[model samples]
Target: MTTNPERTIPPTTAGERAMLESWLDFHRETLARKCVGLDDKRLREASAPPSALTLLGLVRHMAEVERHWFRRVLAGEQEAGRIYYDEADKDGDFRVSESDTWEEAHATWQAEIARARENAAGRSLDDLSAGGHRDIESFNLRWIYVHMIEEYARHNGHADLIRERIDGATGF
Candidate 1:
């Protein structure tokens, strides 16, 4: 097992909000850590046939996810040009091109994360999203936090396998 030094485990004991934030941050760092030492070509390598999943793709997808949940849904703001995918190309973020660079993907994901934190700051956990997302309307901040944690946890598992496959690395 290869341990990534970037992430610190969430504290075992904390308040509700603090715990949620910590775990979410940990999972985010976990994903980034998984891709830490890879080249762009390796980051864009698919896991297997028929599945376009890649580390770079996951980073882009997470950037899209973070923007959607925080900026559009929670903050009730338009993300404008930075949106990574759309209905016309639903899998756009997951389809990494030769042009895609790890530098750009990492920066975008990190930027979205910073924006997510900014959008959530000063808001109570009970606060509702400023708008609806898909078939759902009005997600409380707490739910968004939990949902993000779950999303990252699930994707982090994929990242684990991908990283392992890429460079025989595991653990963070």
Candidate 2:
């Protein structure tokens, strides 16, 4: 059965920034809802053979993504570093270990999301990122929001499939 009906629905019409943030928030809630009632082991369950994707891992990965775009790129904190991954094992976030508890991961992800909001607050959509990453130079808040929406939407799809596989739950 579905869960978490409290997710905010994006308005049919709204200002540009409001629309983007709303959609992003909706997708964020969708991902979290996919994991509802699932235990840590279940949350870490892979999709199938040869695929290590998990809901908890997705949460962690998104945490890293939020930190990178907001704090490191937009806020220009080069030394902020990564939360769950590094040079050797870029997919470490997805490599959910036994030590990684769902509660802790969720809290960390939420913290990153909050910081993302704080960093973007009072900033114009046209404002370029204080720094840039490999290949690209900089991205405006608009671009970051759009990219984050896309990222979450794509992962929510994966989350749907994984949640379905776990206990035949679907269409949350």
Candidate 3:
């Protein structure tokens, strides 16, 4: 299938939330672009040696992350279960299988991204989550956006290397 071209993130943007969301969306598109045109086998290929990081794994992980922060935390859904992974196998999302397909992963990721956007639609950056994970007692929407941007930025670096290793594709 022909993959869509990556959307450009404006170098200069107005407003704090716009800038944050734009960068986050750019990084999200970058990760998707990295996986574009690759089949399930290519998506599940592990990086060199000990790391189990794969393009598909990254997509799954991000879906969980988006859900966790937006739906669970921000929306105050403490009972929400994970889309991937469990207490028995916390890293299950990163553990690929022959049965796992790119279509499934991509669809889940897109759905979670949409849910996250919807959950944050009318919320203000100054709005705080009902609760926070672990040491963080509470978190504001602004913090979540910034954290997600950082998370994507770091993972996109890994994605860049893995994509190149897979097919010599480079640059965003």
Candidate 4:
């Protein structure tokens, strides 16, 4: 029943961006690993108290968050909305149905990650900051990479406990 300590970031160097991406990859892989062997019932099981922090909902939510930050914001598509965002009901990504399958959630998240990787493929940290006539906040490509990595790291922490509680499994 011991909890792992937080990650200690190493000092940055010439390939700092690459290093950040590596960390991001590790966290993403850890998150995916957390959901491994989980069936639909377990994926949707709300083990956390008073809230539905199911793996399926976390998958869907991360997909939307990735899309919102990378596709919409980074690509200068202000009109694009978060997945399932509406005035009628905000946070729709979290509100899962009983019939929601793990496969569908996994697919959606993978696609979103693919799109984000594509958007960042040819560009360096320098290109990400080159905002010309864009209304969204301009950030260095380095910042975007760091921020996203941070987001994943934070969410992965939550995922760790949620996954463990569902089946008593832990560790990356």
Each model's lDDT comes to 0.87, 0.91, 0.88, 0.73
Give the candidate order by descending lDDT: 2, 3, 1, 4
Clashing residue pairs found in predicted model 4: none
Listed in order, each prediction's TM-score against the native is 0.93, 0.96, 0.95, 0.82
Instruction: Choose the strongest candidate by TM-score.
Output: 2
In angstroms, how far off is 95's CA in candidate 1? 0.2
**lDDT measured at residue 113 in model 3 versus the true structure, 0 to 100:** 92
The runs of at least 3 residues in candidate 4 whose Cα sits more than 4 Å from the true structure, single-residue gaps closed, are 1-14, 128-136
After superposition on all C-alphas, the RMSD of every candidate to the true structure, in Å, is 2.3, 1.8, 1.3, 5.3
Score candidate 2 by TM-score against the native.
0.96
> What is the descending TM-score order?
2, 3, 1, 4
Q: Which of the numbered candidates is closest to the native, going by highest lDDT?
A: 2
What TM-score does prediction 4 earn? Answer: 0.82
lDDT of 3 by residue, 1-172 (tens): 2576567674684798888888889989988988888889989998877888999999999999998998888888888789779999999989999998888988998998999999888889999997688888789999999999999999999999998888898886
Worst 10 residues of 2 by lDDT: 1-10
> Positional deviation of 22 in candidate 3, in angstroms?
0.6
lDDT of 2 by residue, 112-141 (tens): 999999999999999999989898989999
lDDT of 4 by residue, 30-67 (tens): 66777887788888888667987777777788888778
